[model samples]
Target: MPKKVDHDERRRHIAEAVLRVAGRDGLDGATLRDVAVEAGISLGSVQHYFRNKDEMLRYVVGYLGEQVTARIVAGMRDHAAPGPVRSFLLSMAAEMLPLDDRRRAERRAGQAFTARAVDVPELGEALRYGDRWLHGRVAELIGRGGRDGELRPELDAEREAVVLLAMIEGLATDILLGMRDPGEATETVRYHLDRLTPQGS
Candidate 1:
């Protein structure tokens, strides 16, 4: 009898291999053949799941996004005891930073995809969707903070959300380039959050 294969699991395995290759050598280095080698699978096996590099890349990017979202959700649950909205936002920001090896690899892969997305309309659209979703969520949180009196009464949630997102992205890039310390990057986030929600109105 032939063994049964879990198609979803196999695809996830391949996605992990893609991440490892892309993370180490950038998107250019993550050829299907190289990914198969990294995954310990046959080239045919990878092709069975991904018709081409673009298809595989799109899947991997979406997979990485799901992983990050899950981590943020888990962090939110852990901090459910919430005192201030700033703490909640800080927790969410922490998940976005590459503070450890696994996250560092993930960030590298994501950055690689982002660069490639410039020429790939599908990839660009997918990334735009993610950015809009994140922006909306962050803006909502900021708006909530304002209403709850946690943030400045005059704060413009929509504008502040964009600033915060840009700050986090800039900090992540610096951390990845070794130009900034992770701890200090986090402290920088906290500092900004403090300014947004000052000790007293």
Candidate 2:
């Protein structure tokens, strides 16, 4: 009998190789051949999973999002505590920033997609979808703060969420471009979060 192939595991292996290539050589260097070599698999095998470069590129964005969501979930689990609004926002923003090597690679991949999204329809749609999803999630978390009475009831959660998301993305860009350090980016977000809660709360 033939060995059963784990399709999910195979995809993740190829996807991670894509990220590893992007980290080392930018997105331009993450061709199928490059990923195959990086993944220690055959070129035909990589092509078997991804029909073409466009399909692979689109898959990568969703993969990166999953990685980020996993990171945020793990962070939430480790810091399991009183679910305060300000801290929640901070933690979310922190997850979005390029604080570590893995995150830095993610940021690079994201930036590469963003640049290409201008010319690639699929990649552009992926980015727009991601933006909407991020905004919706952040807004939901912020709204929870309102219900918890941690943040002001009058606060516009959507507006606040959008601003924070922009700030978080900006910080990530700054970090990637070498204009700021991870600590500085995180502290800046924390400082902003501090004003969101009451003095004694």
Best by TM-score: 1
lDDT of 1 by residue, 65-101 (tens): 8888887767656655434678878988888888888
Report the lDDT tens digits of candidate 2 across residue range 16-90: 999888877898999999999999999999999999988998998889878887867676565455476577678
Q: In model 1, where do residues sit more than 4 Å from their true spots?
A: 76-83
Q: For model 1, state the Cα shift of residue 96 in Å.
A: 0.9
Error of 1 at 98 (Å): 1.2
**Could you estimate the TM-score for every candidate?**
0.94, 0.91
Query: Could you tell me which residue pairs clash in candidate 1?
Result: none
